[model samples]
Target: MTQQHGETAEVRRDDGELIGMLRQVTDGGWVPCAVFGLPLATPRSAEAARGFLLDHGLGYLADRWEAREGGEWVTVQIVEARPGEVTVSYADYGHPKLFNERRTLQEPSPDDLRRA
Candidate 1:
Protein backbone atom coordinates (compact mmCIF):
# COMPACT_ATOMS: atom_id res chain seq x y z
CA MET A 1 0.00 0.00 0.00
CA THR A 2 1.13 3.56 -0.77
CA GLN A 3 2.16 5.44 2.32
CA GLN A 4 -0.24 8.31 2.96
CA HIS A 5 0.62 11.52 4.76
CA GLY A 6 -1.86 11.19 7.63
CA GLU A 7 -2.54 7.46 7.53
CA THR A 8 -0.59 4.28 8.31
CA ALA A 9 -0.93 0.63 7.32
CA GLU A 10 -0.48 -2.61 9.23
CA VAL A 11 -0.37 -6.28 8.30
CA ARG A 12 -2.63 -8.63 10.20
CA ARG A 13 -0.69 -11.81 10.89
CA ASP A 14 -2.43 -15.09 10.06
CA ASP A 15 -3.09 -16.11 13.67
CA GLY A 16 -5.41 -13.21 14.34
CA GLU A 17 -2.47 -11.19 15.56
CA LEU A 18 -2.33 -7.41 15.78
CA ILE A 19 0.78 -5.76 14.49
CA GLY A 20 1.36 -2.06 14.09
CA MET A 21 3.85 0.07 12.22
CA LEU A 22 3.31 3.59 13.44
CA ARG A 23 4.60 6.62 11.56
CA GLN A 24 5.15 9.79 13.42
CA VAL A 25 3.67 12.80 11.65
CA THR A 26 6.08 15.38 13.00
CA ASP A 27 9.27 13.40 12.44
CA GLY A 28 8.19 11.17 9.58
CA GLY A 29 9.78 8.23 11.38
CA TRP A 30 8.47 4.71 11.72
CA VAL A 31 8.38 2.62 14.89
CA PRO A 32 7.25 -0.93 15.34
CA CYS A 33 5.18 -2.14 18.21
CA ALA A 34 5.94 -5.75 19.07
CA VAL A 35 3.41 -8.16 17.60
CA PHE A 36 0.65 -9.40 19.90
CA GLY A 37 -1.48 -12.50 19.39
CA LEU A 38 -5.03 -13.12 20.53
CA PRO A 39 -5.84 -16.53 21.90
CA LEU A 40 -9.58 -16.47 21.35
CA ALA A 41 -11.29 -16.21 17.99
CA THR A 42 -11.35 -12.92 16.11
CA PRO A 43 -13.25 -10.69 18.42
CA ARG A 44 -16.72 -9.93 17.08
CA SER A 45 -17.28 -7.53 19.93
CA ALA A 46 -15.09 -5.08 21.82
CA GLU A 47 -15.36 -6.90 25.10
CA ALA A 48 -14.29 -10.18 23.58
CA ALA A 49 -11.28 -8.54 22.01
CA ARG A 50 -10.28 -7.18 25.37
CA GLY A 51 -10.72 -10.52 27.07
CA PHE A 52 -8.66 -12.39 24.49
CA LEU A 53 -5.71 -10.08 24.96
CA LEU A 54 -5.85 -10.34 28.69
CA ASP A 55 -6.05 -14.12 28.67
CA HIS A 56 -3.07 -14.47 26.39
CA GLY A 57 -0.65 -12.81 28.85
CA LEU A 58 0.36 -10.22 26.28
CA GLY A 59 1.37 -6.85 27.65
CA TYR A 60 -1.87 -5.10 28.56
CA LEU A 61 -1.09 -1.47 29.36
CA ALA A 62 -1.10 0.87 26.39
CA ASP A 63 -0.97 -2.12 24.02
CA ARG A 64 -2.84 -1.84 20.74
CA TRP A 65 -3.88 -3.98 17.78
CA GLU A 66 -5.72 -3.76 14.47
CA ALA A 67 -9.15 -5.11 13.61
CA ARG A 68 -10.62 -5.99 10.21
CA GLU A 69 -13.98 -4.80 8.91
CA GLY A 70 -15.57 -4.58 5.45
CA GLY A 71 -12.35 -5.74 3.80
CA GLU A 72 -10.45 -2.89 5.43
CA TRP A 73 -8.27 -3.13 8.51
CA VAL A 74 -8.51 -0.44 11.15
CA THR A 75 -6.69 0.23 14.38
CA VAL A 76 -8.12 -0.75 17.74
CA GLN A 77 -6.78 1.44 20.54
CA ILE A 78 -6.30 -0.30 23.86
CA VAL A 79 -7.66 1.90 26.57
CA GLU A 80 -6.90 -0.58 29.30
CA ALA A 81 -4.41 -3.44 29.38
CA ARG A 82 -3.51 -5.58 32.34
CA PRO A 83 -2.68 -9.13 33.21
CA GLY A 84 -5.70 -11.31 32.45
CA GLU A 85 -7.57 -8.36 30.86
CA VAL A 86 -7.67 -5.74 28.10
CA THR A 87 -10.18 -3.18 26.88
CA VAL A 88 -10.26 -1.56 23.47
CA SER A 89 -12.24 0.90 21.38
CA TYR A 90 -12.55 0.78 17.62
CA ALA A 91 -12.71 3.66 15.21
CA ASP A 92 -15.72 2.18 13.45
CA TYR A 93 -17.59 -0.33 15.69
CA GLY A 94 -19.17 2.57 17.53
CA HIS A 95 -22.23 1.00 19.12
CA PRO A 96 -21.38 0.59 22.79
CA LYS A 97 -22.89 -2.88 22.98
CA LEU A 98 -21.78 -4.13 19.59
CA PHE A 99 -18.61 -2.16 19.98
CA ASN A 100 -18.15 -3.76 23.38
CA GLU A 101 -18.98 -7.29 22.19
CA ARG A 102 -16.39 -9.88 21.13
CA ARG A 103 -16.22 -11.45 17.65
CA THR A 104 -15.24 -14.83 16.16
CA LEU A 105 -13.04 -15.50 13.18
CA GLN A 106 -14.48 -17.04 10.05
CA GLU A 107 -11.39 -19.05 9.17
CA PRO A 108 -9.03 -21.40 11.01
CA SER A 109 -5.82 -20.45 12.80
CA PRO A 110 -2.88 -19.09 10.88
CA ASP A 111 0.86 -19.24 11.57
CA ASP A 112 2.37 -16.86 14.11
CA LEU A 113 5.76 -15.92 15.59
CA ARG A 114 6.54 -16.51 19.21
CA ARG A 115 8.50 -13.88 21.09
CA ALA A 116 11.74 -14.91 22.75
Candidate 2:
Protein backbone atom coordinates (compact mmCIF):
# COMPACT_ATOMS: atom_id res chain seq x y z
CA MET A 1 0.00 0.00 0.00
CA THR A 2 1.23 3.46 -0.86
CA GLN A 3 1.27 6.15 1.86
CA GLN A 4 0.61 9.60 0.46
CA HIS A 5 2.03 12.48 2.46
CA GLY A 6 2.33 15.54 0.24
CA GLU A 7 4.38 15.35 -2.95
CA THR A 8 7.56 13.29 -2.68
CA ALA A 9 7.20 9.49 -2.89
CA GLU A 10 9.46 6.90 -1.34
CA VAL A 11 9.45 3.41 -2.76
CA ARG A 12 8.74 0.65 -0.23
CA ARG A 13 9.88 -2.93 -0.54
CA ASP A 14 8.82 -6.26 0.90
CA ASP A 15 11.20 -9.25 0.80
CA GLY A 16 13.79 -7.04 -0.88
CA GLU A 17 11.47 -6.33 -3.82
CA LEU A 18 9.66 -3.11 -4.59
CA ILE A 19 6.00 -3.45 -3.63
CA GLY A 20 4.62 0.11 -3.40
CA MET A 21 5.55 3.73 -2.88
CA LEU A 22 4.98 5.86 0.25
CA ARG A 23 5.13 9.62 0.39
CA GLN A 24 7.76 11.35 2.55
CA VAL A 25 7.07 14.23 4.95
CA THR A 26 10.23 14.97 6.91
CA ASP A 27 13.83 13.85 6.55
CA GLY A 28 15.07 11.67 9.39
CA GLY A 29 18.31 10.59 7.66
CA TRP A 30 17.18 6.95 7.85
CA VAL A 31 13.85 5.23 7.13
CA PRO A 32 10.99 7.70 6.90
CA CYS A 33 8.17 6.96 9.36
CA ALA A 34 5.58 7.71 6.65
CA VAL A 35 6.78 4.66 4.71
CA PHE A 36 4.99 2.51 7.26
CA GLY A 37 1.68 4.28 6.53
CA LEU A 38 1.70 5.75 10.02
CA PRO A 39 0.65 9.34 10.57
CA LEU A 40 2.57 11.86 12.64
CA ALA A 41 0.02 11.39 15.44
CA THR A 42 1.33 7.89 16.14
CA PRO A 43 2.77 7.36 19.59
CA ARG A 44 6.54 7.43 19.95
CA SER A 45 6.91 4.29 22.10
CA ALA A 46 7.08 0.91 20.41
CA GLU A 47 4.21 -0.59 22.41
CA ALA A 48 1.97 2.42 21.88
CA ALA A 49 2.93 2.52 18.23
CA ARG A 50 2.01 -1.12 17.77
CA GLY A 51 -1.27 -0.59 19.60
CA PHE A 52 -2.16 2.44 17.47
CA LEU A 53 -1.39 0.57 14.26
CA LEU A 54 -3.49 -2.39 15.34
CA ASP A 55 -6.36 -0.12 16.44
CA HIS A 56 -6.29 1.59 13.05
CA GLY A 57 -6.50 -1.83 11.32
CA LEU A 58 -3.23 -1.59 9.49
CA GLY A 59 -1.24 -4.76 10.26
CA TYR A 60 -1.03 -7.11 13.20
CA LEU A 61 1.74 -8.99 14.94
CA ALA A 62 1.80 -12.13 12.82
CA ASP A 63 5.26 -13.12 14.06
CA ARG A 64 8.46 -11.52 15.05
CA TRP A 65 11.79 -12.40 13.41
CA GLU A 66 14.94 -11.53 15.26
CA ALA A 67 18.46 -11.89 13.97
CA ARG A 68 21.60 -12.24 16.02
CA GLU A 69 25.10 -11.05 15.24
CA GLY A 70 25.91 -14.51 13.91
CA GLY A 71 23.11 -14.21 11.32
CA GLU A 72 20.84 -16.67 13.10
CA TRP A 73 17.12 -16.03 12.77
CA VAL A 74 14.54 -16.66 15.48
CA THR A 75 10.78 -16.67 14.96
CA VAL A 76 8.10 -15.93 17.50
CA GLN A 77 4.63 -17.41 17.30
CA ILE A 78 1.54 -15.26 16.74
CA VAL A 79 -1.72 -16.01 18.52
CA GLU A 80 -4.12 -14.09 16.25
CA ALA A 81 -3.98 -13.39 12.52
CA ARG A 82 -7.22 -11.61 11.61
CA PRO A 83 -6.55 -8.45 9.64
CA GLY A 84 -9.13 -5.59 9.75
CA GLU A 85 -9.88 -2.40 7.85
CA VAL A 86 -8.49 1.05 8.65
CA THR A 87 -10.79 3.99 9.31
CA VAL A 88 -10.28 7.70 9.91
CA SER A 89 -12.81 9.97 11.62
CA TYR A 90 -13.22 13.69 11.03
CA ALA A 91 -15.73 16.49 11.69
CA ASP A 92 -16.75 19.00 9.01
CA TYR A 93 -17.39 22.25 10.85
CA GLY A 94 -17.74 24.36 7.70
CA HIS A 95 -20.70 22.45 6.24
CA PRO A 96 -23.75 24.65 5.66
CA LYS A 97 -26.34 22.17 6.89
CA LEU A 98 -24.38 21.42 10.06
CA PHE A 99 -24.14 25.11 10.95
CA ASN A 100 -27.81 25.77 10.15
CA GLU A 101 -29.03 22.83 12.25
CA ARG A 102 -26.89 23.71 15.26
CA ARG A 103 -28.50 25.26 18.33
CA THR A 104 -28.15 29.03 18.66
CA LEU A 105 -26.13 30.54 21.51
CA GLN A 106 -28.27 33.26 23.06
CA GLU A 107 -27.99 34.93 26.42
CA PRO A 108 -31.03 34.40 28.68
CA SER A 109 -33.18 37.46 29.48
CA PRO A 110 -32.84 39.07 32.95
CA ASP A 111 -36.30 37.74 33.91
CA ASP A 112 -35.42 34.15 32.86
CA LEU A 113 -32.15 34.24 34.81
CA ARG A 114 -34.03 35.44 37.92
CA ARG A 115 -36.48 32.48 37.64
CA ALA A 116 -33.56 30.01 37.50
Clash count, one per candidate: 11, 0
Per-residue lDDT tens digits of candidate 1, residues 59-105?
Answer: 53244455554554554665543222444555345534446444433
Cα shift from native, residue 38, model 2 (Å): 5.4
lDDT of 2 by residue, 1-116 (tens): 23334543333343333222232334421222222232324224433433333343322222231211123222222222211211211112333333223221122222211100
Measured over all alpha carbons after superposition, the RMSD of each candidate to the real structure, in angstroms, is: 15.7, 21.8
- As a whole number from 0 to 100, the lDDT of residue 51 in candidate 1 is 38
Error of 1 at 44 (Å): 28
Candidate 2 error regions (>4 Å): 1-43, 58-116
Each candidate structure's TM-score, on Cα atoms with residue i matched to residue i, is 0.25, 0.20
lDDT of 1: 0.37
Clashing pairs in 2: none
